[model samples]
Target chain A: MHELAPPLTLEQGLRWLDLIGILAFAMSGALLGVRKRFDLFGVVVLGCVTAVGGGAIRDTLTGQTPPLFLRDETYLWMALLGAGLGFALGEGLARFERTLSVFDTVGLALFAASGAVGAINFGLGPLGVVFAGMLSGVGGGIVRDLIANEVPEVMYRRDQLYATAAAAGALVVVLLHPHVTSFQAQLGGALTIVALRWLSRRGWVSLPVRRVPGARD
Target chain B: MHELAPPLTLEQGLRWLDLIGILAFAMSGALLGVRKRFDLFGVVVLGCVTAVGGGAIRDTLTGQTPPLFLRDETYLWMALLGAGLGFALGEGLARFERTLSVFDTVGLALFAASGAVGAINFGLGPLGVVFAGMLSGVGGGIVRDLIANEVPEVMYRRDQLYATAAAAGALVVVLLHPHVTSFQAQLGGALTIVALRWLSRRGWVSLPVRRVPGARD
Candidate 1:
C-alpha cells in the first residue's frame, strides 16, 4: 500500500486501457444501430451514448457532477471516432460478434474497476461500491438495448456472467485496496473480471435460471 | 420575477402535486410489474425505481448529486406505498389502462415543470433545460418499460403526444421564467403539458412518423 508514492507506469497503462474500452463500447453501439437500420444521426448518437453512458451514471451516483466526458471533450472525440469506424465497417463488424465481445468485456472490466474506485472514494459502503461498479460496467449496454427495443442481454442472457463478474471484480478491489496500491488493486480487479468473462464465454462458467411455470417466452 | 418574495401558497400546492405525481408514477410501475408477472420483490423495486428514476437523473444532470430521494427517504416511502396499493389491486387495475393513463399524465406534467425549474436554477441554457425537463417527465416510464422488456411507449406510441408535451411544457417554463414568478411559470408549464396530453389523447393532435423501407417493425 504505497500511500505517498504514485504508480506512474500502471496509471498510464490503465489510462490506455480505458481509452480502448471506450472506443470498443462506442463502436459496438454504432454497429448495433446500423444493424437496426437507424438513420446516420441515430447511429452516431447511440455510439456516443454507449461509450459514455456507464461512466456518466457512475459519476452521477457518486455525486460527481458534470460528468468527466462533459468536462473533457477528448473522450467524446474518441467515442465519435469509434462510432465513425463502426458506421464505416457496419456489416463487416456485425459478422464478428466475438471481436465485439472481447472489446465489450475490456470496457466492462475497466469501468467496473473505475466505478468501484470512485464509489470507495465517495465513502460508499461495500454494497454501494459493488452496485455502482456493476452499473458502470453494464449501464451503457442496457441503455443501448433499450433504445434498440430489445431485452438487455445482461438481464436475460444466462449463458455467460456479466453483472456477477463485475460485482466480483468490484469486491476484489474493495478487499485488496488496503493491502495494495490503487493501480494494483484496479488492475487486479479488471483482470479478475476479464478472466471470469473469458471463462463464461468458453462455457466453463454460467449462472443458472430457474424455470417459471407459465412464463411468457 | 418576484425574486425577493416567495409564493407560499403556490409552493405548497406544487409540493402536493409532486407527491401525487410520485405516487402515480410508482403505482404505474408496480402495475406493469404485476402485469409482467414479476415476483413481489421485483414489483416493489420497479415501483421505487419508476417513482425516483426521473428525479435522480434530472438532479445528476443539473449537478445536484446524491439525489433528493436518497437524502430524503420520504419519497421512497411514498413509492413503496404506491407499489403496495398497485399490488393489492393488480389484475383489477390492469383492466383500467385509462385510469392509469390519467395519473401518468398528471405525473408527467408536474415532473416537467419541476425539472425545468431545476435546470433553470442550475443555469442551463434553453436546450438543456428542455431536455432535462422532458427527461424528468418521461425518464421514469422509459426505465420501467425497459425493465419490463418493452419499447418505451413514449418513443413508439404516436397515439398521444408524451415527450413532445413535456418538451413544450419545459419550453414554456423557460420562456416564462424571465417575466413571471417562478410558481406562475411552473404552473403555466404544467398546464401546457396537461392540455397537450389531453388534446393528443382525444386524437386532436399527433406527431407524424415517416415510414422507412426495409426497416424492421
Candidate 2:
C-alpha cells in the first residue's frame, strides 16, 4: 500500500518528469543524426521524430488520430532543443553514465506506464497491455536500429534486458494498478526494470526460459 | 479524355498491373534489407515490411484495422523471395544504373496508381487523391531513409524526379479510371510517368521550387 493517495495530482512534478524524459530521448535522437553527419534541419527531424515517433505510431495504430505530434508540437520544439543541446553537451553526457542512465530510466518508466495505461483505457486486458507497454518502451529503439541499418538490439540479442525490462514492468503495473498509488507503482516498476537490465549486463541474473528438455546446445 | 470505352477486361488488367507493382516494390524492399546485412529473419521482416509499410500506414490512418500486414502473409513471402533473388544477384546489380532507373520508374507508376485507387475508394476528391498518391509512393522511401539515418532523400535532394512522377501518375489513374480501357489507362499513366521522369532528368527540366529567390554565390 502506497502512502500517496488516489486522485494523484498532476500538479507539475509528474508532468515535468515526462517532459525531461522526452528531452533526453530527443537529444539521443539528435546525437544519432549528428553522428550520421546530417544538416541542422535533418538533425532536428531525426531527434523529434525518434522521440515521438513511437508514441505517434502507437496512437495511430490504436486509432487515436491527429497524433500527439500534431497536437502539442512542443514535442517537436523539445526535439529541436534536444538537437542543439546534444550538439553542445554530447561529450559531457557520454562521460557520465550515471546521469544518462537516470534519464533513460525515467523515459523508460513513463513510456511503459503510459503504454499500459493507454491499452487498459482502450479496453484491453493484461496481455494486450503488456504488448502495448513493450511497444511503447522499445518501439523507438526498433526504429533507431532500422535507421542505422542494423538488427534491432531487442530483436536479436534475445538475452539483452531492454524490452524484457519493459515487459516485466508492464506486468507489474497491471498487478499494482488496483492496489497502490500509480506513482509508487510506476517508480517501483521502473526501478525493477533498470535493476534487472544492469544486473543482466553484469551477469548477475538471468531468465528461467533456458531450461529446455531435450534441447540441443 | 476522348479515347476508349470502359470494359471489364481493362479493369482486370489494371488490377494485375497493380499487384505486379506491389510484388516488385516488395522485392525492392527485401533487396535493400539484404544489402543492409540483416540476418535471415531480419531480412525477411525488412523485405516484406518495406513493401507493405506505406500502404499499411495509409490504411491505418484511414481506419483500416489490422493493417495490410495481417491481411495475407503472401506479401511476406513475396518479400523473402525478392530478398533472396537480390542477395543472389546484388553484385551484378550494382553496375546497372540504367536498369535501376527503369525499375524505379515502373515502381513509381504502380504505387502512385494504387494509392490513388485507395484514396478514391476512401471517398476523397482529386486533391486528396493526389496527396494519397504521393504518400503511398514516397512513404516507403521516407521510412527507409529514416532507418538508414539519411535525411529523407525526398526532402533534401530533388534531383531524382521522385514525388512529381508519383503525383503525375496518380492524376492519370484518377482521370482515366472511368474512361479508356482500365488497362490502357493504368499502363498509359505508368508510361507517361516514366517518360516524364526520364525527360526531366535528361532535359534538365524540374518544378520551379528553389532554395532561395536570390542568393549571391
Candidate 3:
C-alpha cells in the first residue's frame, strides 16, 4: 500500500470557494426540481442530494462513513437554504443561467481538487484518485438527473465537457502533489479546471459524437 | 458506536443460496440489457452493475472500501458469465418470466438477509441495519432501471411489493438477531421475504396508490 499524505485543512480562500460551490450546486438541483414541477419535499431533497451527493459517494467509496453532512448538519442546512431560495426565486432564476453556470464551474473545480486530495490521503492509486475526483465533481448532477428519471446529461451530452473538466483538474492535482504543497496543487488544479470549463462553454466547444451511417431521420 | 459481531463464514447451504441469487440477479440485468438493445459491453456492464450495485452502495455507505467484488474476483467473473448467458439466451429468456421471477425472489431474499447481517456487523443501529439491508436488496435494480432511463419499478410500481419484501426481510433479521443466532436469523429472514413476495404475487396484492384528486387524463 502506498503511504498517503496527512489530511490538510483548507485555507480561508478555499473554504469560501467550497461553500460557494455547495450553494451553487444546491441551487442548480433545486432549479431542476422546480422545472420538473416537484413538490416542496422533492425540491429540498434534490437540493441536498445535489450539494452533498458527490462528496458523500467519494467518502463512502473511500471508507469514510456517515459522510460529512451526517457528521456536521451545516451542509444539510445550507442545501435546505438553497432549496428555499430556488423555490422563492422560481422561474426568475432562469434568467441567471449564465451566472449559475459560472458558479457551477467553480464548484466543479473545487470538488475535483478536494476529491483528488482526499483519495490520495486514503492511499488510493492514480486511477482511484482520478475517479474519485471526477465523481465528486459530477456525481451530484448525475443523481439529480437519475431522480428526475432521465439519462445523465454528462454521459450523453456531447456538448458539455463536464466530466472532462473534472478529470483534468484531478489529474493536475495528482501530478503536482509530489512536488508541491497540497494547497498549491489544489489551487492550480481548480484554476485550470475553471478556465478550461469557462472557455469551453464560451466557445461552444464540444466533444465529438459518433453517428451511425444512414441513421439520420 | 455499538460493538459489531465477528464476521461469519457462509455455511454450505447459504453459499449455494448466495450463488443462485447472484446468477438470478445477473440474468435479470442481462435480460434487461438485451431488451434495451444495448451493445455487448453495455449488456455486460448492466449485468454486473445490477448484480452488485446494491451491495456496493450499502458497503460504501457503511464505510467498507474496495467492496467485496474488488477484494474477490469471483463476483466479477460470475457477473460476466451471466451477461454472456443473457446475450446467448436473448429474448428467449423473456418467455420464462415466471421462473425468472422465482429466481429473482430468491435473490432478493438472500440479499436482504445478508445485507442486514452485514450492517449489524458494521455496528449499525436498527434503522441503519434495516435501511442497509433493503438497499442491498433493491439498490442494484434501481440502478439498472436508471441506466435504462426509466423510473425504478419499486418506487412507482405499486403492483409489485419489491421494496416492501426486501424491507420485511431486513426487518426480520434485525428483530430476530438478539433472540437467534446469525445463521438462524438470516435463514428465517430470507424465507419470510421469499414467502411474502411469492404470496403477494399470487394474490395480486398491490399497495394502494394515492391519486391526485383533480388529476385528469
Candidate 4:
C-alpha cells in the first residue's frame, strides 16, 4: 500500500506532521463532545472520527480503501489518547482555546500538503489536487459538526479561511513540484497554509458577501 | 475487485434493487435541498452524495477503493436525473409522501442485504457484518441531514424503526448465509426488513423512551 511504503525524507516529514495534526484534531473533537454532554463512548467516537474522517474521505474518493488509519494502529491510538486527555482535562482545557486553534492550524496545513501530494501521485490534475487537499483539511470538521447537528463551520463561515488556505497551499505544492525537491515543495506548501491562516485570523479577513441586485441591504 | 465481479443471480437481483433505491434516495435529498433554499448545484450535489454516501462509507471500511459508484457512471446519471425530477416537480412530489416512504423502504431492505453480503465476503465477523449492513442502510440519510443542518433522524428519533429494522434484517442474512443459497439468503433477509419496516409504519410502532429515575419527571 502507498501509505505503508518506506518513507523518503519528504514523506517522513509529512508523516510526522500528520501525527501531530491527528492528535490535535482528536482533542478538539473530544472537547466538542464533552461540551455537548455526550457519554464517554460518544466522546471517543467523535474524537477518532474527527481525526480520521477527512483522510478517509480523500482515500475513498481516490480509490485507496481501508484508509491509512485502518492500515496502521498508530493514528488510531493517538486519536484515542488525545480524546482521553481532552476528557480528563475537561473544562480546564477550554481555557486554552488559542492553543487549540494553533494545533488546528498545524493540522490543516499538514493535511492539505499530504492530500495534494497523494492526489498528484494518483495522477490527478491541478483541480483535483487542490480539491483533494482542501477536502482533507476540512472534511473532519464538517463531519464533526454534522454529527453535532450544526451547520459545517467551513461551508458558510466566510471569515474562517479554512478551505481557502488549504487550496492556496495545495496550489503552491502543485506549482513547485516540477522544479523543487519533494521535501522543499511539501514544506513550502504547508508553511504557506499556516501563514495564510494565521494572517487571516489576526486580520479577521473574510470573503465578501453579496446581496441580490433588487434586494434591500 | 469485489465490486467488479460478474453478476450472479443474487448480484443481479441486488443490482436492480440498488437502481431503484438510488433514484428514490436521490429524489429525497434533492427535495431536502429545495426546502433549504439551496442553489441548483447544491441540490444536485446533495442528491448524489445522499444516494452514494452510505455505500462509499461501507466500501472504505472494507478496503474497497474507488467505490462502486465511481467505477460506474450509471449510478451518477440516475442520481442526477432524480434530482432534476425533484427540482422540476417541486411541491407536487410532496403529495406523494406515502409513495416515497415505500420507495425508501425497498431501498433500505436491498442496501442492508448487499452490505451484509459484502461484509461476509470480506471475512468480517457476524457483528461487523450487521454493523456494516445497518450503516449502509442509514449512511445516506445521516449525510443528507448533516448537510442540511438537521439532527439525523436515525440518531435521535426513537420513534423511527430505521436502524433497528436494518440490524434485524442483516442478522438474518448472517444467520442464513452458511446454510442457504446466496440468492435465497439475500432475498429472505431483504424481505424480512421490508416486512418489518412496513408493519412498523402501519402500526405506528416505536421504541420506548426512558428517563433517569431521579433526574427528570
Candidate DockQ values, in order, are 0.15, 0.09, 0.15, 0.15
How do the residues B136-216 of candidate 1 rate in per-residue lDDT, one tens digit apiece?
Answer: 998998888878888788897888899999999999999999999888899899999999999997899999988899887
**Model 1: residues with Cα > 4 Å off, grouped in runs:** A1-8, A208-210, B1-48, B61-63, B68-142, B146-217
Q: TM-scores of the models, in the given order? A: 0.61, 0.55, 0.60, 0.59
Candidate 4 segments exceeding 4 Å error: A1-56, A60-134, A137-149, A153-217, B1-10, B84-92, B156-160, B211-217
Give per-residue CA lDDT, model 3, range A1-217, as digits (tens): 9999766656766877887888889999999999999998898889889999998877777777778878878778887888788877878889988888888999999999988988777777675677679889988998888888776666544456777788789999999999999888888888879877877777666554323334342
Query: How accurately is candidate 3 docked according to DockQ?
Result: 0.15
> How do the residues B1-217 of candidate 4 rate in per-residue lDDT, one tens digit apiece?
3578664775666787798899899889888876765545456557777888898789877877656665566776777788777766665678877898888888899988889988998999999999999988889998888798887788756656888999999999999999998777778888989988877777677787777688763
- Candidate 4 pairs with clashing backbones: A63-B66
Ten contiguous residues with the weakest lDDT in model 4 chain B:
B36-45
Report residue B61 deviation for candidate 3 (angstroms).
6.1
Q: Arrange candidates, best TM-score first.
A: 1, 3, 4, 2
Worst 10 residues of 2 chain A by lDDT: A36-45
Per-residue CA lDDT of model 3 for B76-146, tens digit only, reads 66776876787678777777778878888998999999999999998999999999999999999999888
The alpha-carbon lDDT assigned to residue B215 of candidate 3 equals 81
lDDT of 1 by residue, A28-99 (tens): 999999999998889999998999999888777668767888988889999999999889889898777788
